[model samples]
Target: MTLVLSACSYRYGRVRPYVLRAFSYELPDGLTILLGPNGAGKSTLLKLAAAVVVPQAGRVSYGNLSSRSKEFRREIAWMPQSITPLPSLTAREYVAYVGWLKGLSRTDAWERAQQALRRVELTEQEGVRTTQLSGGQIRRVGVAAALVHDARVLLLDEPTAGMDPRQRRLFRDVLAKLVEDGVQVLLSTHDVADLAEEADHVTVMDRGRVLLSGDTGAFLVEAPEGTAPGRVAEGAYTALLERGEQV
Candidate 1:
């Protein structure tokens, strides 16, 4: 499956259009990290892919489905940066609800909910109220919900934000597993230190345009030696931020 974005741009009232231009790249069935600094339109691009916000111009397509299609919604799992669960539901119940929304039968939804919790390492805490979980734990629950339907495309915005080092490692393992299973992943993160070994491709965006999009190995080779990978990534991120300001 591939997501194609052609000449997409978004505009809000009064201000000049955020000029996200014509760009097309195929997302293979592996991890693709979207890297950029704040306000570079990384989130905007993800939202465009998710079909949450309509593009003012151009089109986005996924396989045979357009961005507005129900089939497109079924094929993609989007985990936003901040997810607030229903106050009264337990983690397990919440995941089951998401599964149901994805069109799973009651029995299948419950079973998948259990498996999703296990996948996120939240099985032991399945019965805990969503409101009772810590920030990291809540994020795990959100991940579980995202995975419950087994969507082919997973779009995660900072999936490891509140996680500790160990949890981050665990999440990386989970992402690797998804890649192995042929799930296409598009993740946005500031955690460059943790990504070097796992991400297959990196797309660096600056001011609503891609500055770099290539294999991770090429990026490492191009980056200065003796510089921490995180620093290199940060420099690229900073450059994007500056570019956004220029626009």
Candidate 2:
């Protein structure tokens, strides 16, 4: 599924400036990293794509599935930066509930929840109450909820925010399996170094505008020569932001 945003515009309030103004881009297949500074409208973009918010103008679609359609909602999942667990629900219950909300039957949701938890390496903690889980564990629960429905597209906002290095690697491995199953992912993050071998494409944004976007290799090529392999993504991203400021 190709998620595309066409001439989209959105804002929090009528008096406030638009967070995304005429934003238009087609999401590339596989995993694409969305990089930008604070208040760059990355979250808003993902929210719109996830259909969590309505676009004030233009359209967001996954091929023939319009954002307004229930099918579109079912085919995509969004994991926000914050995961506030509902009181008293265990991790498995929380995920299963989300699956049900996404249109699954109770029996199916329960079964899928187990599989999802396993994918995020949280099966051992599945019976733990979400409120008692650590920050990173809660984030994994959130990822499990997102995966519970077998969504074709996933929109993640700082999904690895509280994860340690090993946890991040584990999360990336989960993502790799998802991509291999032909799931489209658009992940927003400030951690450029993590994208070295993970990202299939890169899109840089600032102040509601895209500065640069292309395949991972094309994005890396923007950096100056002699850039260390580990620093190439960071270097290219910084250069793009600098050029955007100069524009």
Query: What are the RMSDs of all candidates, in order?
Result: 2.8, 1.4
For model 2, residues 1-247, the per-residue Cα lDDT tens digits are 6899999999999999999999998999999999999999999999999999989999999989999999898888999999998878999999999999888999999999999999878889999999998877898899889989888898999988878887788778888888998888899987776654468999999999999888988898889888887788888888898999999
- What overall lDDT goes with each candidate model? 0.79, 0.90
Winning candidate number (lDDT): 2
Over 4 Å off, model 2: none
- Lowest lDDT block of 10, candidate 1: 235-244
TM-score of each model, in listed order: 0.87, 0.95
| lDDT by residue for model 1 (101-188), tens | 8899999999999998997788899999999887878888887888898888888887777788877777888788878878888998
